[model samples]
Target chain A: MSDSTQVAATPAAPAEVPVAVRRAAAKPVSFGQVVGRSPFVPYLFLLPGLALFVVFFAWPAVEAVEASFTDYSIVNPLHVVGFANYTELFHDEVFLAALGHSLIVMVGLLPFSVAIPLWLAILVNRKLRGIQVFRAVYFLPVITSMITVAVAWNYVFADKGVLNWLVATLGLSDAPIHFLLDPHWALASVILVEGWKGIGTYMMIYLAGLQAIPGDLYEAAEIDGAGAWQRFTRVTLPLMRPFMAVALAIEMVNALQVFTSVYVLTQGGPNDHTTTAGYFVWSQAFQHYRFGYASAAGVVVWAILIALALVNHRLTNGKQANTP
Target chain B: MSERQVLRRRRGARWTVRRIGVYLLLAAIAVVFVWPFLFLLATAFKAPTQDVYSFPPSLIPRPPVLTWLHNAWTQIPFPRYLLNSLLYVLGGVPLFVLISAMTAYPLATASFRGSKVMFFAILSTMFVPAELMLIPRFLVANQLGLTNTYAGVILPGVLSAFGVFLLRQAFAAVPAELGEAARLDGCGEWRVFWTVMLPVVRPTLAISAIFGFIFIWNDFLWPLVVLNDDTKYPIALGIAYLTGISGTDTRTLSAGTLLSLVPIVVFFLLLQRQILEGAKGAVKG
Candidate 1:
């Protein structure tokens, strides 16, 4: 609007600002000058997004901290209560059990997420037709909702579901496997679901890493009479380290927050066997009306995650300096 | 030169059995990865006797019928949900792409004052889990009187930090001289951005679009919390309703799951090639 007004008043633009001043400032700026001229433009572009980040991401985290120290209930309303919720969570056995289960699920899922995906990516990365279809087929669950995957899979693993039907027919068992309903299988089931969702994503990451390596490395090795196994062992393994690190780190952090599947499939049910730290927090805040306690749990989860991130950062940094 | 070929021939003969064995193993694993879908697809068409699992499991329905599929189609009005999903995705993704690309350009390319603070501010958001925003987001939506509306569902997701990061990486990787050359060729600032800069990163844009489609399509939590009307829900939520009734009405429920999965499956098949390329780009970028 203002630009149009200025264009309209150009003949009489001296009224806005004198042409004498304009001529003084009208000397052409250098190419180097333009790089520094719009120092504020980038900031201006970033301002709205930065504001959103702080409000939705950063501020809610701060709010979670405050909520943890208060006596908040969905039914009775919230007010200050110094350390009451934290104190309660510390003593709760089920909360402890849920926390343990979360760790167990993380442990069970980490190797599968990193190792299995990398293996599969390597196997399918060969020069072959329909490999693209294989990748797409594998990654379908990843792009789909973890929620739907959990629900559909629940039927597939049900007592009278397809898995059990197959198991019985193979003479593996006389009856259906109690995958979801049983205590022993419940947490493992959740981890398996997470691994399934993640394997495709890891495959893509590994594929990218593999593609980035120069073909000359393999060609040069082949000219030196290196066998396929020798080439893969000496070349692929070393080149793939960075990708493995990234894949491992991401899978670790993500597995900490496995909520959707647990919420939908288990609902913290079958004697609370499938509850992870995330679903535990959800149940506390939303279901049981214990916002204060849930917030404390959230804080604990955050701290643990932060500590692991720090350790990973330090280890990776150390290695980066030591290696090329 | 021929020594390499002799080595290859000897090794190929030696590893023939092993290569075939490996392929067989991979094929078996592929079958396992795909088994659930096959079962679900069959169950969607199975009759009562066919649906029920016994000692001898049936791979295919002895007499397949569309009864369950018909029931599922009518029960949830699956077509309405697809329309709602299309409206939601169409309204949100392009806006997100624009905002993300525009916002990330300066962060990536230009040298500016206080850039670190802005960069820090953006990076910090990546760690905040989506679960953390439940109450405040609800409060914000309610204050705006947008509860259960399209605005509520689409607005928050459109301004993602991940999108900004993705676009920034793309824009930053472009040669700066091309941008300078464009500017010297008599382009305006907006022209330089839209005409000169955007085309260089078409693959990144495609990646963002595919990502936006997936995340928005399958989302259930925000919709479950925000949208009350079943008709406003995306296809996944519609399927959740199937689960809600899957316990009681087995046949109809199986059909509903299949109906819900069809769009995603069709989409995967249609864009399988582009999706693979997009995945590769994701790794590179």
Candidate 2:
């Protein structure tokens, strides 16, 4: 049986054909022909994945939309309350604060997610020995669980933690800042951790963009007597705009949904200062069991995300067109 | 010295200085990335008499001890949680890869009637944020009698847009000739796919598996939502549980957290090259 199978698998017949002729002939014979001409075979292959997608994603999405309009809870009988949740949410101080906090996290993350990562990528783009080791070290936090990150940083943010030690030793502050306890510092502290954990990912994205740039472009800029900064601005920046857009878009989405750090670091406490829109949705549904209200808030957050993505798309495209 | 030779030596000195400056800068930034974990490790092993936080932040333990590690292990079902995490990864990743590959195979190799539509529809799932899906997906799982079960945690996560997207790209890159030759040998589509196409994309398959392993291992939120029983909690969630109970004992918390990180970190160290390369490929696609 093994001998027969081996004999049948030989490709000697196709090898005899001229390369160009074989290439031309191969174009018409799709893999479906090899699959015994069954039109249903493809569907059969796709069935399991499509079924899971529908059950988990599509159905849940539709239910989310429908649940937003109803006063649904774990205990109560569902009743239609069209737009009341939305109206109330706009007026709700906590929800609005959460939205504002999400925005703050987004803005706070910009330097880490964009600027610093770009600089790091450029620095690491060299063809030096031990560079890959440095790259892996930089990316270590991105792979570690957020729970672990939060725990590790707890030591860093303790009353007498390294950060406090630095501040005090540098004479920046006489007293230690309550990094996770004070309302003023709590959200910012969470943002700092979020940004720190995320720099590696953004750096990797920028490194990918950097590696794609041809060496000749830099050589050409050098031949023109362009300095390093001038070459970066003239040749690299324009080419990297698309990557920046990607990094910015990802950072925005991540910031808007900042929950794990908030959960682990502050639990959205100290007067709800760290309460982001993502955390609000989770707390409302799971903590309060207000499924409908949470769904409404979720829909609003989803809308904002989509709108921001669209605005980002337009701005990136507009800038691309404006550049010489 | 000749004028040209002096000029050359001075330029070379400056170049060496600049290279040293770059290395110093890189090492400094790497410290920023690595210091937290190092501090965690130091705190975990520090003797009980030693202060975990101090002026200037001493990172070296006076004498490392295993007391906290033992406490972390014995305090709350640590081994059980680790096993649960292993179970989740083992249960989820294979299905994730297999489903992704099976789904991608047809979309890439055959021109079915709705292949394009199917691809786009699946791809759009990436935009639906997990926060948005939380309530309804939980409800769906509840309806399916899946909540509070391992399947609930594993099933919804097994099908991700990233996996499908990555595998589709991989499958499409396979040459058509291999599949054709197998077919000419009177092999069926399944045989062709199993023997020819799949082997050709083994590197991509390994990449997907590595990503899947990392994702499932580090996942916290969904498992937190799905599992009501503490016994079923994965290591990440278990560490959070440890933090909640161990409150002020930073040493024990650090030890538990460090313990949870070990497997994933070792796995990453072994496969960092593939991971870093795969990350670039993922973005470009």
Name the runs in model 2 displaced over 4 angstroms. Answer: A1-36, A310-324, B1-12, B109-111, B175-188
What tens digits encode model 1's per-residue C-alpha lDDT throughout B1-285?
599999999899888877777677777877767766666666677777754554444558768889988888877878999899988889988978887887788877765566677776665555545555566566666776878999888877776766777788888788876766555444444555676677788788877877777778888888887888887998888888877866667657767877777777787788777667666665454
lDDT of 1 at A289: 71
Candidate 2 lDDT for residue B42: 97
Badly placed stretches (over 4 Å) of model 1 are A1-33, A165-175, A219-230, A320-324, B1-23, B186-188
For residue A135, model 1's alpha carbon misses the true position, in angstroms, by 1.5
Which pairs clash in model 2?
Answer: none
Over the stretch B151-190, how does candidate 2's per-residue lDDT look in tens digits?
Answer: 9999988887778877888888777767776666666666
lDDT, residue B257, candidate 1: 73
What's the TM-score of every candidate structure? 0.88, 0.90
Chain A TM-score relative to the true structure, per candidate: 0.84, 0.86
Error of 2 at B254 (Å): 0.6
Candidate 1 structure lDDT: 0.73
lDDT of 1 by residue, A26-69 (tens): 44422223544344556666666766666556666777888889
